[model samples]
Target: MDKPTRLIEFESMLFTRHTIPFNARKWGAERELDRSAYVLLSRIQIDGPLSISQLSQAFGLDVSTLNRQTAAMLRAGVVERIPDPEGGVARKFSITTEGERRLDADRARSIRSLERVMADWTPDEVAQFAGFLNRFNRDIERLEGRPWPRP
Candidate 1:
């Protein structure tokens, strides 16, 4: 195939692959937390507290959308709003102990599912795939000027 054709095929495959994690069988059905809440908790865990505006910029989402999501999170006790550590007027969201516990459990479940799916893959193959995926994400983040902090 020509390069352009190949790129198109790759993009389609990427979207298909992205859906795997969101599949109910893989990660959704086993968790009480919705994907949005899990993702928000994960971000706060990695990046520290962040205001809705900051999260909106990082995720390329609207402030109103984040406001709604964070409101739900607050009701669930997954996060708490506090004065921004940077002394901003806006409040930032931070994960609570309950959120941490739930996030960790959900993450463990997802990892187990992935492990089962990749049971036949060699360790080297797994490591190489992880490296490539990480590189791809980092490059995109760089271009977007919203690089996630490295664990």
Candidate 2:
């Protein structure tokens, strides 16, 4: 009997491989902040100050994991915890001035990386691709029962 055919998903593999190298370079260049720290900072920058619980829900991480992550961020002076002022038992976490600086640097680095990758693509093509990527993310979120921006 012939051997069973193997299924291939080149697109998934290609994208995953691309990110592995991209994030490796990113993490290597910015040794002060690990990838999770960067991601948490970025989320705080976008979502504003939020309680640990809120962050836990958003990231789907448990409280203990978030607590450790936040503690490291606090020690690095990247984030500060303050009273929620919204009637919460737990304090809220906000990006510190240093965090903003780091975030800006990271954003610039990311832009440079993207520019290098898309140097051959036209602005129109980039825009279309970005739109498709956004839509794809939204669709995935929907499938996972997550809320996304309304049209």
Best by lDDT: 1
Candidate 1, after superposition: displacement of residue 109 in Å? 0.5
Question: Per-residue CA lDDT of candidate 1, range 1-151, in tens?
Answer: 7998899679869766765445646444468578899888888999999998889987889899999999999999999999888898999999999999988877877777778778999999999989977998899899999887777
The digit string of per-residue lDDT tens for model 2 on 15-124 reads: 66675323746444443467788878878888788898888887778999999999999999999999886877878999999998987777677677777778999999
Q: Which of the numbered candidates is closest to the native, going by highest TM-score? A: 1
Model 2: residue 29 alpha-carbon error in angstroms = 4.2
State model 2's lDDT.
0.77
Superposition error at 83 for model 2 (Å):
0.3
Q: What is the C-alpha lDDT of each candidate?
A: 0.85, 0.77
